[model samples]
Target: MHTPLAVEHGANLKQYNTFGLPSNAQALVRITSESDVRRVVDDPALGLAPKFILGGGSNLVLTQDVRACVLKVEVMGRRVLETRDDAWIIEVGAGESWHETVQWTLDNGLPGLENMALIPGTVGAAPVQNIGAYGIELKDRFESLDAVDLITGRSVTLHSQHCAFGYRDSIFKRHLAGKGVITRVRLRLPRPWQPVLGYLELERKIAETGITAPDARQIFDWVCGIRSVKLPDPAVIGNAGSFFKNPVVTPEQCRDIINRDPEIVHYPMPDGTFKLAAGWMIDACGWKGKSIGRAGVYEKQALVLVNRGGASGAEVVTLAKAIQESVYGRFGIRLEPEPVVV
Candidate 1:
């Protein structure tokens, strides 16, 4: 016998999203497995209706009440799937907390994910965003993922090439967006576990501590400490972390900006492009600690937009737009928001 789908109508989503923005889903179903997703796809009413896949809600901005059926991915599991000579493969449920998973890997003697520690979201959502921090990205550690097609209710496994990962993006965010549900994720933590210390912050930590050969746990702790000091806790102060993506510009554009402002923060990419700091641009445009309605720029980090009290999604968008305009007007570079505005 098949389990009955337990659907909740008019579900309040304020608590689901990290931003704490108020929004309601017309219908919400907690998806626990791939079979649950298939059932949703097979249902007569829901199958035809528009669907919205919701994970940890860390990288989302709900602008209004959702009319579509919301599939809240709640599947849970974590284990070392394979222990290869060169790498360890760990499979995780889509719903598992990203930071917790990173900790779990380290606890289990795995250390490749230390650089991405403290990232707020689910394991499933990581691939969709190709989430990165410090010096490592999700793509670097990714193995493959299992997803259920919304239309056919068919399970599919995709590898790195299929994911089409770019800076904070993947196929899941593009052509396959809202068309399927990621059920499980597999991570490849390479052996030999060399610490990624190229990032300025990590380098600074090394300089300060005089511990050039820090372990994975130490790196994880440092990353968490750095993030805690830079970002506001969602429980205490609602935020979606890094409101905008650091814009990539040509060398000519970088030089132009550099000529105009001698102290602009930027970094060279492997592709020969320059990644300009969005937060620095916003700060240069004088947006730090500024407010629009109940939404405000975080004082410590201009890239993050925070809810002063009970800020609405529209207020957040408005503030983001204002910041974008100001930064563009000054830097001649458009800042792209990292969050998916629903």
Candidate 2:
């Protein structure tokens, strides 16, 4: 006989999200396996309730109490699934800590994931956000993923093509959002691993140390060091990293902004577009280190919004919207938030 599904009603959610915003889940369930997800889908009452799949909660801003059934993914495991002449395939459980998984790979001599070290959240949330840092995105090493359909309770596997990965986005954030729960992710680390050092920070690190040909471990350490100095620890001070995405604009638009503000930070994309630095723009607009209510913009980085001691989720949203308005008024460009506000 199957074990009874334990559900926590009116579960406190302040601890689940990185922002530490005050909120509660109407019903919460710890999902430890694919079967656990299927069980929730199969249950008459829970099956009928709207569902929300939660991972490490790093990429989220809970603006209100969740009325849906919250499935907290806690599944954990990691293994070298295959070692081929061309690549090494590593499969990781959805609930595995993303940063820990990166460290684990490096510890086991798998070098490709080092550039993405120190990223917050869970493995399952990685593909959903197509999380990237330094110069490597999750898609760069993606193989396939396993997920259970919320409606049908049937498990499915999807490859890169089906994922529709874009800049910090994937199918999970679009058509498949809230429709299924990712259970496991398989990463394909290409053989003869090469370091990705295209970011400006990495370049500076290379020049500073005169280590032009740094290895994967060095790149990893450099990324960790850079991020640690820039971002505030959520444990100490509640925050969701990078409140807004760097806005990508057409060449003409970029030039227009450049004409207005010569010192605007902008980078050329491979497709002839330009990605303007959102944080720089916010800082330019004088929003950095500013606060609205108890929510405040992080002094160290304008892209992050923090909860200043007992701040509510509504306050966080208010601050973000105010910053958005300020930026839009000045730049005529809307900054989209990186975090999922709900």
lDDT of 1 by residue, 1-342 (tens): 897789999999999999999999999999999999999999989999999999999999989999999999999999999999999999999999999999999998999999999999999999999999998999999999999999999999999999999999999999999999998999999987899999999999999999989999999999999999999999999999998999999999999999999999999999999999999999999999999999999999999999998899999999999998998899898899999998
Q: State the C-alpha lDDT per candidate.
A: 0.95, 0.94
TM-score of each: 0.99, 0.99
List candidate 1 stretches off by more than 4 Å.
Answer: none
TM-score, candidate 1, is: 0.99
Candidate 2 lDDT at 329 equals 95
